[model samples]
Target: MKFRVLVAVSTLALTLGIAGTGAAQAQSIAQALAAAYDHAPDLQSALLSAKSSAEDIVRAESAKRPTIGASLGGNYNWAVGPGAVGPGGTNPTGAFTGSSTFSAGLSYNQTIFDNFATEAQIEAARAGAEAAEYQIRNTEQNVLLDVVQAYMDVMTGQQLVALRQENLTFFRAQLQSAEDRLEVGEGTRIDVAQAEARLAQGEAGYRAAISSLEVSQATFQRLVGAAPRNLSGGHDFSRLIPGTLQSAIAEAETGHPAILLAKAGIRAAQAGSDAAQAAFGPNASVSGQVGTSYSTATGTSSGLSGQLGFQITVPIYAGGALGAGVRKANIEQIRSEVDAMGAYDQVRAAVIAAWSGIQSADAQITAAQAAVSAGQEVLEGVIQERDLGTRTTLEVLNAQAELTTAREGLINASSGKVVATFSLLAAIGRLTAADLGLPVEVKTAVPYTQTVEDVWQELRTVAD
Candidate 1:
């Protein structure tokens, strides 16, 4: 309960940017994930790439839409020579004549038909966009996993630092006790030297532990977008995992971002192949232009000239280029399908690994807990024996070392359990913000795509 109060106070201070001179904010795993989701530059890059790909849809659709453009120009010309003719009449020898003309025009062009080439291109673009969206999800999962690992590292490091400090303090007291006993002739110099050696080792170990913890804190800050605070070491993401390995593998095979991305790739490649084949089909379009021109020499203006025309292009032969393109696209399509199969296999393997990791961590935690309990009793008994002269200083130190090792193992196994559980969640494609039910708005290309695909706008932008 007191810890809860500290957490509240720390969290409030952190929120207000005045967390200094107090206990660190008890940043929860969920909060860290949310912050990382919001701040991940990797995720942002993916989102941007997805939005850029979404523009392809517009580019493809443009093939079927009418386009209008305007032109304006003014031209001046001069002629000189005996044979040069002027706007008024033939120019005299060595005389120069000039004329100015102004013209303005507008042209409208629309695609009448192109077999199904444009349609295939549009489909391909849409698939590409879909693939990019999957990429964003994949990147999000990766960033969140990184944050989880970093957060856990700092949590584990903090505990290790405290353990090492406690060990250091204990060794210092032991050294003092040995010195006191020696002055009273109750202990030998060897005992005092042994205690001093242990104390020196403890000091070095404690310092090394502090250095490691500081490094972990830096990494945590980099990934979570904030310095590590009083992060809670207790996080169980096993609930997010499927009930069994088979179920988890099935989920990943079907729903993993990599699988989805590969599927989209296949679709896009198929569309590209179709587009390449469509090149053999006929294409038709209609275009029109209207313009007015004035001639200063004639002191006359021509009536607005209008012309309209339609064209149909039927490919006869193209030096084998068209066939080659079709073949290449077909090959790409095949590759995409093969890649999809590979993704399925990879995701299944990852699921298996993560599932095994969770079980291993569980077993380690159990064994380490038992070892820690036994180690404490053994260390206590050895210390008592040493004080009674039945055990030497070295023996007591050895017992202490064993207890410390057990405690460290317990800390590591506990941390590994949480990390392993989260790893399993990530492998099963359930590590997303929505999957975790985080409180941040999910970033997606939907808004940008919807706006860009809607009726054309002269200027449009979407706020990040």
Candidate 2:
């Protein structure tokens, strides 16, 4: 019975020894991150949003240009009237008849001045567009962090499944030994029943681990945009983490996307406030029109004319609308400033939390590793003592269970450490595709912004 149990244990041990060595290809963590950076829907949506914001600059600058319009129409008129000649000739009155008149014209209007309100609006729009660019980085960080967590989850789940399989094998060996001892009249029925119960428990645990693994696999596929196969263990990002907490906080203050976005908001709001104040001043514009008409009743040249004019609109009194706008804009500016200050606090808090998580995970990993080693030694001794009849079968089973638990703990702690390391990088604003050196094209908002910033751009239809 002892020999059969040892053979089964040895077989499983050999299987595990060769598990990491095979023809299967190992997918690295960098590959997963790169895939996520290219395919994540949230990141893609943010990119599109930033592109949309770029158009705002174009719309704001449109006020600085001239607007031209053309029109053509032909109208028929009928009338009968007595016409008298001024020369006092006999029967000089004649019947008048109607005729058709055709006309065409071109009109143009240009804003010559607006108290710099348009300029202020353009500045506000530019600031908003810049803020949108930072939003993309913010979204990138979020998606990448999720990918990191999912990657570690899959790794941890895989380890748990393997551990459960090993436990199932060990339990089967215990059951076989119990049955053999019972047949030889060296063990009670209770021992056999206890072993059977342990085997059943092990099977349940194995199934649970398999379910957990499936969940992790689905999450990995969702975030990484592909099925996970032969994935290597999660990477050690400890080197990417800042050396000190103070350094991390400082980095967040200067480089964090959230803080940058808030600062941009403040600038946009200040520009808006300036624009609102300008509303109280006069708006000046130049307009011109030219038209020619052909009428059968008169010579065509008689209906031709051209005119040019300039106008200024001074805000004498509105139902207090302009004043209200100025007040609202000032309030928004204050709110934006407050939000920027709040963002700084939020970034600092996040850095502290992430740093603490890394420290805790490090300690947990060390303690769990040591426990696993000690548990293995204790199990070996307990098994040996059972063979010498100095320990009960239950004691051997307990020792085996303890060792398995310790190993599982170690697996979770190690995975947590990896996740925490990357999280610290995220907190410090260094968790970006470019910072990580991912082999993918990083989309930027500059190209679209530059394209739309032309003050003399002509209207064109955009392709779908």
CA-lDDT, candidates in order: 0.84, 0.84
**CA shift of 161, model 1, Å:** 0.6
What TM-score, over all chains together, does every model reach? 0.89, 0.89
Query: What is the per-residue lDDT of model 2 for residues 23-93, given as tens digits with 9 covering 90 to 100?
Result: 26877788899999999999988888998998988888889988899989888898777676556764555
Predicted structure with the largest TM-score when compared to the true one: 2
Question: C-alpha displacement of 6 in model 1, angstroms?
Answer: 26
Model 1 misplaced stretches (Cα beyond 4 Å): 1-24, 78-97, 458-464
- Residue 183 C-alpha lDDT in model 2: 97
* Residue 5 Cα positional deviation in candidate 2, in Å, after optimal superposition: 9.0
Question: Counting only residues 3 or more apart in sequence or on different chains, how many pairs clash (N, Cα, C under 3 Å) in candidate 2?
Answer: 0
TM-score of 1: 0.89
